[model samples]
Target: MGLWFLNRPRPIKRTISVILDFLAIPFSLWLAFSLRLGEFYIPPNQQLWIFVLAPVLAIPIFIKSGLYRAIIRYIGMDAIWTIARAVFLYSLIFSVIVLTFNDLAGLVPRTVYAIQAIILMLFVGGSRMIARWLIVKSDHHLWKEVNAVRYIPPVLIYGAGRAGTQAAALMKLSNQMRPVAFIDDNVTLWRQQINGMTVYGVDQLAKLIERFKVRDILLAMPSAGRRRRSEILKLLEHYPVHVRTLPDLMDIAEGRLEVSDIQEVDIADLLGREPVAPINNLLSKNITDKAVMVTGAGGSIGSELCRQIIHLSPSCLVLYEASEINLYQIERELASLALDIPVYSMLGTVLNQQRVEMVCRRFGVNTIYHAAAYKHVPIVERNTNEGIRNNVFGTLHCAQAAIDAEVETFVLISTDKAVRPTNTMGATKRFAELVLQAFAESKTLYNKTRFTMVRFGNVLGSSGSVVPLFRDQIAKGGPVTVTDPEIIRYFMTIPEAAALVIQAGAMGKGGDVFVLDMGEPVKIVDLARRMIHLSGFTIRDNDNPNGDIEIDYTGLRPGEKLYEELLIGDNVSATEHEKIMRAEECVIEWPALVKIIRELELANKHDDCQKARAILLDTIDGFIPQCELSDWLGNDN
Candidate 1:
């Protein structure tokens, strides 16, 4: 019956609290007088009226204090403190009324009022606390009944700062995760209780994991330095908990924090290098107030370029992509940014010269960022005919159209694999570069269009990047694959790559090959090991045979080099930007390049794989085919 009453409507609960305060106020005053007289004495007429009217003053005080606004189940110490203040004020007012009446002055001692104040505070505050405890206990049991199939994931917060505390409070009220404790590097916070959970030092992480069976760890250190954050990630790598983190401080300034804001560790955080701020002048040089168009605008690098382009206040931006879905997605996203500039989404392939010419003419394109290409090495190697047709011929068509339209600047997004290539994708890209270089060499063509190419290494989170592959493999609790133990590759974030591309394009001459300074190359095997460790899992190797994940080396894929090179030759000079460089390499004349394009067109038309391979081998310098003609023949059949 008592449980049912506690669970009644809001009005009933408020009425019950008001009535209790009314009854407790008079009883406390009566007790004070009886104790002062040392007997169970009835109050005199003047004092009786004081006692009876005391509740009237106290009830109004309680209501005005907002004491009943807080729900009992969630009431905390702050709410209890408010009750204390309200009772003290009520007692003081009642005492003033008694003293002013003069007839009730001698009826009760001044000390009785003080005693009544203390007793009233206890009754009022204690009753609320008791109700809160009972409701919380009942709700917890009911929560368990509603969720019988799966237990909530237990979590540990890494930082004990304000962000960490806020995240903990949010997690506690969520059904997806339950915060178990806090792990702080600060010694002063060690072993202290925060919001009911004990804070432990970094050294006690393993012990806490065992005690609580923790499954996930949240990194709430939004302002931690990169080196310190990396150190913490390294320290937690060998444990068995999946790691997640909150966004930086900028996200918090936008709005309130929520449990859903926690995200998986970004690949950039693992790189441990602060990104360089883009130069405002260089970023806005060619883009501001210019008519710009990006082919392959739906691609990883192209899409990023479009996003950054819209912010530069371009007069108009055009997206020319072959894929229907990719073009639609980028179009929708740019439209939502609600920029004042016009965004034209055109459905056309770069391989069609007429279509490229028409779009260039229609838009009066001031600058063209040609990013469309068949970039996947293995896939391109299997389909060599289509790869050459798209990468080589598509670039030729775009260049011709730009020259005809008198587009001021044309930038080609090249790859590190284009240097001394071994595969079809790399050779085709190098051929595309040669095509532009040939155009730059011709005096008449150079006067019409300025063509430049920016070459860089692998971009993390790109379509075929290994970072997402490793993350997916780790999540499945199995063996992660690497091409070769000794293989290495340079990596950069997608945004950084796009920024460098824009800056490089702005600094280009008629036929310059701009190369980005891709930081040190990382070993693939070491990267796999580090990824497993940072996710709180040990490598399954010979030393620790009972590890969580195993690293497997599948032999290198076809046409995949152990390492990639950005510059074709030793003749390289630094540009104005620290990250961009000018590579003074070889180039073919327009006549020679045109002849090679004609041969490629004929070879593709006849479905002659051998002839096409021979053309690439003879045209591109230092070109070597890793697969036999029969290997491609099998794919063709």
Candidate 2:
């Protein structure tokens, strides 16, 4: 019956509080008189009006103070403060009324009014505290009864700041997990209590995990930098607990998310470097009020480029893609995000010179970002002719079209694999770079298009990236395949990469090759281990036979290198942007490059894979075939 009444409608509960306050106010005055007189004294007829006036004055004050508006179960210090102020005001008015009436009807001691104020304050404030306790206890009891069979895991919050306290409060209301304590790096916070959870030093992590049986740690440091987060993650990785983090501070500040909206640790945090803040001037230099187009606009890098470009307020945006579904998806997304900016989605391949040129002319394109290519190494290796046709000739078609349309800027998205190539894909990418370099130097197309190439290594979350592949393999519950234990690759978040690309494009002189500073190389095997451990899984190996995930080294695939390089040679110099550098690498002159393109075109036209391979080997200085030709069609020839 008590629980049912407590669970009554909010208005009914509020009315109950009003009735309680009404009865308590009069009773408090009577108690105060008795205490002051040192006997069981009843109010005389003259002072009887005082009892009625007490409630009449106090109830309205309490209501006006918003005392009843606060939810009883969630009441805090602020509500208590409100109660204090409201009661003091009511006491002052009641004392004046009593003193005036006493002068005419009956004598009332001055001490009685003071005593009444004290009693009334205690009754008003203490009752709400008591009610809050009762409501909280009842809800907790009901939750326990209903979820008796549910097992709520005990977890630790890793910060004791405001975000951490909010997360703790959220945890108390949730049935999924129970917060055990807090782990903080601040020594001053250690051994302190926050939101009913004890803060402990890093040294106490092992003990806390053991004592509480904690299987997860919630990182509530939303404002922490990537390097600091990486340090903390490295420390946490030593434990058996799975880790999750709240979104960035901006997200929380914008009200897009709450501290309790925790997600799996962002893989980018493991990179140990803060993303360089983008320069607004450089970001909008070529894009602002200029008609811009992005090829492969539906791809990982291409889509992110589109998202960033729209925010720069272009005159109009054009999305050119070969895949119909990719074009439609990106077009819909850009339409919503573009707002007032016009977004034109064109479905066509870069291989068609006429189509590519016509789209540029129709859109009045000022800048073109060429991202379409056969990027998957093994897939491209198996189709050498198709790889050359798309990566090399396709790039040629786009550059020629941009030149014909007199586009102001043409930025080619090149890969680290293009440096000192060993695969058909890399060779073709290098060839594509040469195509742009040759065009930039050509006298005939001089000053028509400022051609630039931004070269960088793997981007996290891009299509065919190892990060997602490993995550999927881990989710499936068993073996995670790695290409080689020794292989290492540089990684940057896709957004960061796209931002840098935009900035690099703005900084371009004709034929410039910009290399983005991809911080440090990470070993593939170590990355695999970290992902497994962070997911709360142990690696299965000779050392640990009873582990959750087994990492299997599949050896390097065809054309895959042990490590990737951003520059072909060491002729690199810093640019205005700290993360971007200009590489003074060799380039083929137009006449020679034109001859190479014609030979490759004839080879592709005849499906003569050997002839195409020979042209790439002879033209690209560092091109080295890593294995026998594996082209599915070339094998028969």
Candidate 3:
């Protein structure tokens, strides 16, 4: 019941409002006549017929003034103006009808229209105000029906800006989550009341949290860049309150803002690096008025790149995806962006060199962003053949096709896992990187297309990321599992990773492996502790017996690492930008790498697991056996 009125049913409301509109007309007429005359006189017997026809005749004028369509529940000053117009028209017609009889001709003049209009407005418009009050009363009743909003843990909003105010109003409307107070850093708004709620100072956060029993603090500074937002989040992190943030403003699709727009706070907020706002002209320089093709455009990073690129005013955007559902979803989303840019989706895999080449030739694709890859480390470790086929062979196919088509630029989204790999997944990714490096060098000599790879660490909220897994485990009442107490990983937000990739694509010359500086690594155990505490629970261990939830150490899984590195070798040099660096590393020539690739491909065809493993070992140096080679061939668990 509480949630019901908070988010109402639209169709039922519209029908109810239309009925109230017709009834308010006669009600206002009686109130007007009785008020102006200073007495409650009954209508004359002959005049009853005139009042009946008055409603019928006035219906069109009222509709023309748009009064009939004015919703009582959402009414404001606009509805009042529409009511006034409808009233003047109705009263004028009624008076003119009486004057035709000549009996009351001299009694009422043209001024009666103005008088009746004012009276009708009072009763009809006043009734709407009454209706609004009733609806609000009912809404409030349902909201506090079970006192759910109050029980939802008191929350404080950080900003009082337009977006913050919008978030606050939405919170008021959503009875499930109540914002106890507003906390603005701005001195001008301190202590002032907005929509009847007192605005508190940011300095008063501690006092307010204690007094109000605040259990959550929503960071409403969506427009704040990463640096400012990180500072604000760090200040709030000290208190044991779950923190959430409004997503970046550019991503906010317009409508009356909804509650879903608010996102659970991410660890990337700690990264402290502000995203370089993409210069639209620079982003559009090459893609605008040109045809673009994105291979694996339905995968995590790939799909996002497609979504962002479509806005660059491309003449045509082609999505080449191996997955059916992902392709459909991306296509639908692109259509909704509504830029009127043509989108062509083809069902094809990057491993099929012929298919990839045919599509590039047919579409005349100018730019290609190769994003499809086998990314999950442990999963890829188990399916070694598939990983090598998809990541290495697949990339070879796309790069060849891009070269064949003479595409201007080709960017591959690489990962930190590719740096000095110990597992099959990492080795494949590294091999793929080497393939691009070799291709770029050969291309420079042969004078062909440009190729680049953008390498970065784990992006928050990707399909296989730890954040979502932790959130899900936390959502369920119980022990949150951490792989190891000392395990640490670098994190980057999805958008930030995507943004850097785009910027990297533009800055590089060719075959340059660009590495983004993912700020200081965070311990998995520490992250789990913060999550538990912020979720309004105490971590249980030998230290605190009365704790609510326990954090357990689940021994590391296959191909798991205690720590990860971003650079493979120390020969990395600073690029034009501060965060990006170009790593100079060893690369295998096409002839040498091709032999190993062919042997591996043949081994996979025969399901000869040993030969495949042997080929991988010979191909990538420093390939130490981290988890016993027996596990790779048989069920050794």
Candidate 4:
């Protein structure tokens, strides 16, 4: 009950503080005099009222100094200065009173007044410091007791440089985390001391973890490159301790450093792909001062392309999306950014040939980034006709509209699934690429529109991405699902992919199929285990059935592959950009491709799922359906 009262409200705490100061002032004065005289001294009647009135005089001054407003537990060294200032002023007032009264001046010894003033300063300043210490320590003890943990988890900070030292000093003051030692890659800094904490080499990490019982590692190499950081994370992945990385040097330079700046290791760290600096000229080549339009502008890839395009100083941006909510969301976000560029959100699908042509011509669009398509493999597999219509015919109509509108460039966002595909989604994406190729080579009546296709694998954090799924499953404290142990995927961040797409589109000399260099594919099973371990959860396997998270293998989904390829042929050549590669693949002539497209359109129009599948299988080279029957369309029959 007393504890409850103490914690009731800020006003109660402030009131209690004022009362304590009143009682302490007179006691401090008496103690000061007794200490100065080296005996139990009592003041004479004439000067006695001065010591008694000390509280009345000092309380008002302390209150004015805002002493009671500060939380004792959170008070810093600056509070000591406040206490000293109030005390010094009070001593001066007392001296003035003594000097004004002849009786008081004669009663108090001159040497005693000087000694009392010094002692008074100590009592006043020391009281607050002691109170702060007591409160902080008490709170720490209470928190530890409630947690039932025998010891606060000591964190070992990696990197013994300036950033690491600062992080260690900051973490030491944290009640929940204690900084134990430093682990640096520098051999010369090993065995050195920073703030009295020993710094050890990376070789000693295992021994130090065991010795100090380190529960987590704080990565503070803010200036380290992505390659070096990835190496450190990979090494730490084998350890049982949870890994956290600090914000980059930009954040530190902006004075945003905090305990919360330490974030969990992202999937990008595990991807181990070194980020390449984007070329400015390439990024803004076709976009600067030009009207740009992005179909499916609300989808993951499309939305990111829109974001990147706006920064390139496009004169105007037209967001053409099939989903009203998605279109509104991107439009609202762009509006909130308050960019000078004009933004027009058109609610229509790429399938609407007339609408696509109208939007292109209405905006005088210089470039069209076609990202509209059915991308999810299983969903597309279950809905074959819709997938082909959207992915295949959708690309055909959009490209045709671009040509008619005399657009300067048209870029189709293709996927790795399009390479020697086993899935209808991949086959449709491949067909979209073929459509662009056919258009680029055709004898057209309209102005020649440069048609380009940029193909890459999965992007991290996009819709239907496994990263978010694994994260959600881990957060729920359950069995994380893996499609197959052997399944491997190439992942890139959305921004990087968008940037590459823009650059690749700029390099296109019509009919060019550019494939961005997707770094080494990551195994799905390994990815799941690492995610669980990095999150401070143990994998529950046959040997450790009692562990935290269980890994469940659900087998592959429909139209899914164990691995995906970025290129269809060995005729791949490096471009000026090291990350972007150009591929030369066979393309059907305009006459043949137009005939095939017409048949595909008629088949889709009649809802002939079997005929559509047959056309895709026959038209696309090396295209193989997982099965002969259309299971999803049986109900329509």
Ranking by TM-score: 2, 1, 4, 3
Query: How would you encode candidate 3's per-residue C-alpha lDDT over 1-637 as one tens digit per residue?
Result: 3234335675665455456656666655655567667789477766566556656777677768876566555677888877877777787777778679776555444454566567667766786687677777776677676575346556788888877777876776776577778898889898888856678887898999899888878888777777887788667767867788887676554644578877787566655666655655546755788888888788888887887888777889999999999999999988887788899999999999888889888988887888888888777777777877899889988988888777888888888877767787777878888888888777443345678888898887788887777777888866899889899988877776776777777776878888988877878787777667656667778998987789888988778788888887889998656667788778887677777778888987776767877877787766654675567665521
Predicted candidate 4 versus true structure: per-residue lDDT over 250-362, tens digit per residue? 87777567787788777787777777999889999989999999999999999999998998899999999999999999999889888898999999988888999999888
Task: Report how far off residue 394 is in candidate 2 (Å).
Answer: 2.3
Worst 10 residues of 3 by lDDT: 1-10
What local lDDT score does residue 198 receive in model 2, on the 0 to 100 scale?
Answer: 93
Residue 533 displacement (Å), model 2: 1.4
Estimate, for each residue in 1-637, the C-alpha lDDT of model 1 and write its tens digit: 3356567999989999899988999998888877888889787665567777899999988899998787886688899889989998998898898889776787679999899988888899888888877776665565576558678878999998889988887776676788889999899999899988889998899999999999789998989876677778878787888889998777765657788999888777777656677888989988999999999999999999999999999999999999999999999999999989999999999988889889988988899999999999988898889999899999999999998888999999999999999899999999999999999999866666889999999999999999999999999996999999999999898999999999999998878999998887889888888888768788899999999999999988889999899988999998888888999989889887788889889999988888999999999998887777667676552
**Residues 465-510 of candidate 2: C-alpha lDDT, one tens digit per residue:** 9999999999898699998889999999999999999999999989
Model 4 clashing-pair count: 0
Error (Å) of candidate 2 at residue 155 is 1.2
Q: Report the number of backbone clashes for model 2.
A: 0
- Those runs of model 4 whose alpha carbons end farther than 4 Å from true positions after fitting are 1-154, 160-178, 191-198, 207-214
The TM-score between candidate 3 and the true structure equals 0.76
**lDDT assessment of candidate 4:** 0.85
lDDT of each: 0.88, 0.88, 0.76, 0.85
